[model samples]
Target: MSADVIADFWPYVMIVVAGWLATDIWRWLGVLAAGRMREDSELLVFVRAIATALVAGVISKLILFPSGALEATPMGLRIAAAATGFVAFLILRQQVILGVIAAEFVLIGGWLLIGA
Candidate 1:
C-alpha cells in the first residue's frame, strides 16, 4: 500500500482503538465481575434501582422541559402519553414493548392533532 493510503487509515485505526479502549475496558471488567456476582443480591438490587431512577429522571427532564422540536409538543400531551403508556404497561402485564408502542402512538397522534 502507498504511504498516503496508510496515512488515511491511521486516524481511523486510532479512532477505533480509542473508542474500544474508552468503552470496552469497563464492559470487560463487568463481564469478569458478573461471573462472581449474585444476581439477586441487595447491592445489585440497589444498583438496578439507581440506574432505573436515573433513566426515569432523564426521560422526565426531556418530556417536561424539552428543546427544539420536542419543545413544540404540548406538556399536557406528553404527560398524558406517559400516563397512558404506564396504564397500558400495567394492563399488558408489564410488557415494555407494548407500553412503548402505546406511548409512541399517543405522542404522534397528539402531535398531529395539535398540529405541532
Candidate 2:
C-alpha cells in the first residue's frame, strides 16, 4: 500500500485495536480475580443489584418514552402493550425469555397495526 493509503487506514486500525484492548483487558482481569472469590458476597450482590436496576431503568425508559423509530408510536399504546404482555407472561408463569418476547411482539404488532 502507498503511504497515503497506510495513513488513511492507520487511525481506523488503531481505533479497533484500542477498543479491543480496553474492553477485553477487564475480562482477563476478572477471570484472574474470580479464581480467588467468595460466594454471594455483599460487594457482588450490590454490583448485581445496581446492574439490574440500571438495565431495568433503561428498559422502562425505552418502552415509556422512546426515541428515533419508537418516537413515531403513541405512548399510551406502548404502555398498554407492555402491560398486556406482562400480564400474559405472569399468567403463563415466570418464563422470562417468553415474557420478553411476548412484550416485544405485542409492542411491534401494535405499532404495525397503528401505523397502518
Candidate 3:
C-alpha cells in the first residue's frame, strides 16, 4: 500500500492490536505467577473469590442502575426482564447467549410499550 494509506491506518491498527494483546498478556502473566502454587492454596482461592465477587457486584449494579434507554422503561418491566433472563439461563442450562437475547427482548418490548 501507499505511504499515505499506511500512515492513515497505523494508529487504528495499533489500537486494535494493543486491545487484543492486553487481556491475554495480563492473563498469561497471572498464570505464570500462580502456576507454581498449590491447587488449594488459600491465597489463590481468595484471589479468585474476590475477583468473582467484584465482577458479580458490578453486574448487579448495572442491572439495578441502568441508564439512558433502559431508564425509559418501568422498574416492573426491568425486574421482569431480569427474572426472565435468569429463568432463560437456567432453562437453557446456563447458555448465556439465550439469556442475553431474552433480556434484550424484554427491554425492547418495554421500551415500545412505554413509547406508545
Candidate 4:
C-alpha cells in the first residue's frame, strides 16, 4: 500500500489490534474455561465479591472526591445523583443502564439548573 494509505489506516488498525489484545484474549480464555466452572463455586463467589467491591469503591471515589468537571459540581448534588441512581436501579428491576441514564440526567440537570 502507499504511504498515504497506510497513514490514513494506521490509527484504525492500531485501535482494532489494541482492543483485541486488551480484551478478546481474556474473553476467549474465559469461554474455554467456563464449561469447567460452577456458578456456585467459592472462587466464583470470591471473584464476584471482589468485582462488586471494586465497583463500589470507584463509585464512592467519584462521589466523594471527584476531579475535573465533576469537581465543579457540589457534593450535595453528587450525592443526590448517586442516590437517585440507586433508587432507579432498585425500582427499575435492577436495570443498570436505566440507572446510569437517570444518574446522568440528574447530574446534568442539576448542573444546568444551578448554572454550575
> Which has the greatest lDDT?
4
Give the alpha carbon lDDT tens digit for every residue of 21-57 in model 2: 7789878987786675666787777767887998999
For candidate 4, the per-residue lDDT at 27 reads 79
RMSD (Å) per prediction:
4.1, 3.7, 4.6, 4.2
TM-score result, candidate 2: 0.60
Instruction: Decide which is better by lDDT, 1 or 3.
Output: 1
Local distance difference test values of all predictions, in order: 0.88, 0.82, 0.84, 0.89
Predict model 1's lDDT versus the native.
0.88
In model 2, what lDDT does residue 82 have? 84
**Residue pairs with backbone overlap in model 2:** none
Q: RMSD, model 4, all Cα superposed?
A: 4.2
Question: Which window of ten consecutive residues has the lowest lDDT sum in model 4?
Answer: 28-37
| Pairs that collide, model 4 | none
lDDT score of residue 13 within candidate 3: 85
For residues 56-92, write the lDDT of model 1, one tens digit per residue. Answer: 9998998899888778788999998888898999999
Which model is ahead, 1 or 4, in terms of lDDT? Answer: 4
Off by over 4 Å in 1: 1-7, 10-18, 33-35, 57-76
Q: What is the lDDT of residue 4 in candidate 2?
A: 100
